[model samples]
Target chain A: MSQILVEALAKTYRVAERAPGLSGALSGLVRRRWREVHALAGVSFSLEAGELLAFIGPNGAGKSTTVKILSGILRPTSGRVEVGGLVPYEDRIRHVARIGVVFGQRSQLWWDLPVLDGFDLLADIYRVEPARYRKRRDELVSMLRLEPLLAQPVRQLSLGQRMRAEFAAALLHDPQILFLDEPTIGLDAPSKLAVREFVRRLNREQGVTVLLTTHDMHDVEALAERVIVIGHGRVLTDSPFASLRSGVFAERRLHVDFAGPAPEITMPGVTVRSRDEGSLELAFNPADIPAPQLIAAITAQHAVDDIHVDEVAIEEVIARFYDLHDAREA
Target chain B: MAPLRPYLAAFRARFQLLLEYRVAALAGFATQLWWGGIRIMVFAAFYGAHAAAAPISLADAITYVWLGQALLALQPWSADPEIGHAVRTGGVGYDSLRPLDAYGFWYARSLGWMLARALPRAVLMVLFAGFVLPLVGLGEWAWRPPSSLEAALLFIPAFVLMAALAAAVLMLANIVVAATLNERGVNSILTPVVIVFSGSMLPLNFYPKAWQSWLHLQPLAGIVDVPFRIYFADLHGGAALQGLALQAGWTLVLVAIGRLAMARMMRRLEMQGG
Candidate 1:
């Protein structure tokens, strides 16, 4: 059986609506209108143990809603969600004990307490035995480079520092599954890399099942083995990262810097994307004509200064994907 | 022991964090002293007007006023501020992630916040009103000691129950705030109700005779009037036990209601951000 299974999950929210003026506000006091929002519309997916899956979507795409449901924070309107053989919402206490969650926009640590004290409180909250807690605390402290940060109050730490402390706080109990919602949001380049590296190590070395939702495509490229692209509360694609990339756009770009004025390339599968005085850009499908053969055909007839092939940017692919499905936030 | 560890830890951490706000404690003590002085003068005038017809003696009235000021923070004047802030900012979602009973966790923290804020002021009020007034030859106006040895002994458990009852009441307020997603309406309504019914504004005895029994039996009375009455031995013997029972009963009832409300609210909770 899959370690995490969500079948036909649906969550609808009744939002109170009102009109735009004082008269509307006064009338709203007497009678209110409510609109139902379908946050999750029959979404289904499953993850085996130790699998790292990246859940990517635009804003308001129900990514966080799904994570909240799976983590037992919110009960879905209708669905079956089981984590480690326990229904997440029904058996919350038992299920939550086995999963660690970090919502990067929020801090779990007490703002006024020192980082170490917050960790101690979490240790007790999770009821880890004293000796085992000490070992785990020391390991996480060193791993996240939180030793120097232990004495500083959480309010005083920078965003990067606090995020590291949050990661340690969430994992202090050695949970089997970790759910990270936009864990690298608002982080600098180095901090983002550090977060990615730590998550990768935790997933690979510790064999921890990780479900990450992020807008950072680099996070998906670097950490996730499988990707699930969700849009409008529905999973659009679930496959290996490479396959998703290929499936979305198979056309690769080749930029060539010719030794002389660029020559026209008239291949069956290739088209000239752009032509400049001393350079040429061509788009081609590798399946139609292999890169090596195309390169050989080019060099065989013309002098080539430099040539390199590049895949489309991941951000562009996701934007195009969102467009294809009309999944942009309303 | 293991099951209770999380609540205990939450309590201790909040207690320690709140204790660090020494300035707030000092400011509160000063404010309470000002109010205590005004209330004592008002009672002295009222007693002078009808000395023989008064329900209690002026000295006991003075002590009750001092005690009310000293422990005013124990009243469930509003929901826990941290919980209110969490509800507004959507941080309340993080609270549900913990593998513990939600009501118990919040109740522990509320108890800690109340006690920590009340303790220093209580000690300071005792030092000034109990000792300094007597040393300065104004003993009649001072906060007197418990009326008898038995009253002193019973006051201990009463005090503990008072804290529990306050936390329970505050938990209900917190649930309301969570359900409404706004603290202003509940808090504005709660403050006046708590002030009047908790006997902080005036002892229940001072109220009209017809309303006396109902006032004494109400839950907020356990927070102030019952406990303070026990301290003065006014509700002694079987009556004192009744007061303690009232405190305990109300605490349990409020906690039960709070637990139910919290469960219902959490089921429908929708965290509004990604």
Candidate 2:
């Protein structure tokens, strides 16, 4: 059985609506109008133990809503969600004990308390035995390089520092599964790499199942083995990262820096994407013409100074996929 | 022990954090002193005008005023500000992630905040009003000790129950804030109601005689008038036990209601933003 299973999940929210002025406000007070928003519409997915999956989509795509439901924070309107043989929302307290969650935009630590104090509070909250807690606390502290940060209050830490602390806080109980919602949002390049590295190690070395929702394509490329692209409250694609990339856009690019003025390419399966002073950017489908064949064709006809072949960036691939499905934010 | 650890840890952490605000405690003590003085003078004037017809002696009224001033923070003046902020910012979602009962977690923290703010001021008020006034040749105006040994003994449990009742009431206010997504409406309504019915503004006995029984039985009365009256032996013996029972009963009732409301609200809680 899958460690986490969500089938035909649906959630609807009733939002009160009002008009634009004081009169509208007064009329709203007398009689209100409510509109229903379907945050999740029959979404389904399942994950095995130790699987690392990335949920990616544009804004308002219901990724976070799904994470909330799986973590037992929000009850789905209609669905069957089971984690480790227990329904998430029904057996919330027990289910939560087995999973860790980090919402990057929110801090679980008390703002006024030192980082270590927050850890101690969490240890007690989880009711970890004192001896086991000490070992776990020390391990996380050293793993996250939180020794110097232990004494500083959470409000004083920089965003990167606080995010590290949040990761440690979530993992102190040694949960079997971890949920990260935009965990690298607003982080710098180095911080993003660090977060990715830590998550990878936790998943690979410790064998903890990871379900992450992120907008950073690099996060998906570096960490996730499987990718689920969700939009319009439904899963658009779920496959291996390599397959998703190829399935979305098979076109690869070859940039050739010719020794002289760039020659126009008049190939059957290739097109000139851009012409620069001394370089030509050519796009081709590897299935139609292999990269080596295309590179050989370009060099044979022209004196090539520098030549390289590269796949399209993941961001562009995802954007094109969304466009193909018309899944841009409404 | 294991089951209660989370709530106890929450309570201890909040209590310790709040106690660190020494300057806020000093400022609150000063404000309470000023108000206590004004209320004492008003009572003295009223007693002078109606010495024979008053329900209680002026000395007892003075003691009542001082107790009210000292423990003024014990009143459920507003929902816990932290809970209010969390509800507004969508941080309350974190509370749901914890492997603990949400109501018990919040109740522990609220109890901690109330006691930490009240204890220091109560100690300071006792030293100044109960000791300094008598030393400075103002014996008649000083906050007197409990009327008898038994009164003093009974006041201990009464005081503990008072804190429990206040925390329970504050939990209801917090649920309202969470449900409505705004604290201002509930706070404005709660503050005045707590003030008048708790007898922080005036003695419950001083209210119209016809309303005295109703006022004495109300929940807020356990927070202020019942306990303070117990300290002065006005509600002694069987009356004191009844007052304690009223405090216990109200705490249980409010806690049950709060738990139900919290469960219902959380079922449909829609965190505001991504």
Candidate 3:
């Protein structure tokens, strides 16, 4: 059974539009103007138990909007959204107790309270049993390395340290599904790695389903096997990372360092993409020119000291997808 | 019992949190003291002017002023600015997800803050009034604990109903302000209205006859004025019981209205996405 299901779920906001200056403000009060912004346009997706999917998009791409709707925070304007067999907006309290949400930019911990105090308060809020709460809290604290920070007031902790506390707070109830919205944002290198590692283990070892939305491509690359890209209130692509890479840019680069000055290497199937001095970079589809044939031809033609092949960057692949999406819209 | 347990725990936690900020609580109490002290002086001035042909004894007027000052500290009709803060900051979304009821959680927290603010202020007002009022010939005022029968029958219920009504009225105001401005400025503007109608600044007795009648009908008057009239003055008969009933009735009605408004607003709520 699917852990989360959303079908044709749409949400539109009636936003007040105002011009600048005092006269405009007075006119707005007398006769206000509103523009409808379609935040989510028939967005539909489903997730299975223990599935870790990255929901990626550009700014204002309805990523957090979808997360809020799924987590029972905001009601969708139209269509159906079911998580764990319950309509999220209608059964908000029941649904929320079963799902954990961690927003990287905001700490859920109480400002004046110690980290443990916030966790204990959450235990009360969720009505978790004392024994189970203690066990889960201890496990999450250890996994997130929050023992040292547990006694400190939340306001006293650094952003990275506080993010660890937030993770522990969200998991204190032992929720089955986790929605992470930019959970590793603003973290240092070590903290980011720790968070990624923990999220990976949580999904793989504990069978906790995860739906993560982030601007950090590295987070998607490190954790999510499957990526779902959305733009302008629509899903652009949903596929495994490898499939995306291979399908978008299958051609690889071959960097050749010649023993002497290299000659201009120009072939029908292969072309020199970049070069400087003795080193030459080549690009060609593998189907058109086999790597072995290309290498042999290069070696035969020039004295090569070293050679290496590189895949296209994931950022470039996503940029191409965005350009395609925009062109279609235009 | 099941539903009430969560509220009880929340109430306790809220009380603990409020108590931790002892210095802030003391400062809030001091501010209340300054206001009450000024009102008490105003009463003494009035007594001095009318001493020659005093309609009521100087002691009675002094007692009435002091009781009004004390009860004003316990007035629950003040809005919590945090509700607006929570909504604007997107924290209210998480609050809505708690398993406990939203109205009960806020009510309990507000009650906890009232006690934190009121208890110290009551003590300070009593001490300060005792020292200052008598020197100005406001006459002797004694700690006349309500006679046993009156205590058992009148004061307890009157106090409870009055506080509940104040809290409920403030809560309704909170909902309206939260919906309109997503801020608590509406309540700030209405504070003077509460003071005038609730007889916190002076006894409702001093107001014009028609205005007094209208003020009596308001929820604010039931909170402090009616209770003050019963306890501080030697008002005859079951006026205390009747006023208590009126206060309780208003509390129930306001609470129901506030809850309905909150539910509707929450359904249409939108949080800023960052």
Whose lDDT is greatest here? 2
- The candidates, ranked best first by lDDT, are 2, 1, 3
lDDT of 1 by residue, B191-261 (tens): 99999999888888889999987898899999999999999988999999999999999999999998999
Candidate 2, residues A1-330, lDDT tens digits: the string is 999999999988889999979999999999999998888888999999999999998767789999998998988899899999988889999999999999989999999999999999999999988899999989988888899999999999999999999999999999999999999999999999989999999999999999999988889989998999887788888899888666655788998999999877898889898998999888898888999998888878889899998777756776777788787665
Instruction: Mark the 10 consecutive residues where model 2 chain B has the least summed lDDT.
Output: B265-274
Candidate 1 lDDT over A1-330, as tens digits, reads: 999999999988899999989999998999999999888998999999999999998787789999999999888999898899999889988888889999989999999999999999999999998899999999998899999999999999999999999999999999999999999999999999999999999999999999999988889989998999887788878899888766665778899999999977899999998899999989888889989999999999999999999876656666777788887666
- What ranges in model 1 sit over 4 Å off? A22-31, A249-315, A322-330
- Native-to-model Cα distance after best TM-score fit, residue B115 in candidate 2, in Å: 1.0
lDDT of each: 0.91, 0.92, 0.77
Give the Cα error of residue A300 in candidate 3, in Å: 12
Q: List, residue by residue over B94-187, the lDDT tens digit for candidate 2.
A: 9999999999999999999999999999999999999999999999999999999999999999999999999999999999999988999999
State each model's C-alpha RMSD to the native.
3.3, 2.8, 4.3
Question: Could you estimate the TM-score for every candidate?
Answer: 0.92, 0.93, 0.86
The TM-score of predicted model 2 comes to 0.93
The clash number for model 1 is 0
Give me the TM-scores for chain A across all models, comma-separated. Answer: 0.83, 0.85, 0.83
Cα lDDT of candidate 1 equals 0.91
lDDT of 3 by residue, A175-218 (tens): 89999999988899999999999999999999999999998878
Candidate 2: TM-score of chain A is 0.85
Better by lDDT, candidate 3 or 2: 2
Clashing pairs for predicted structure model 3, backbone only: none
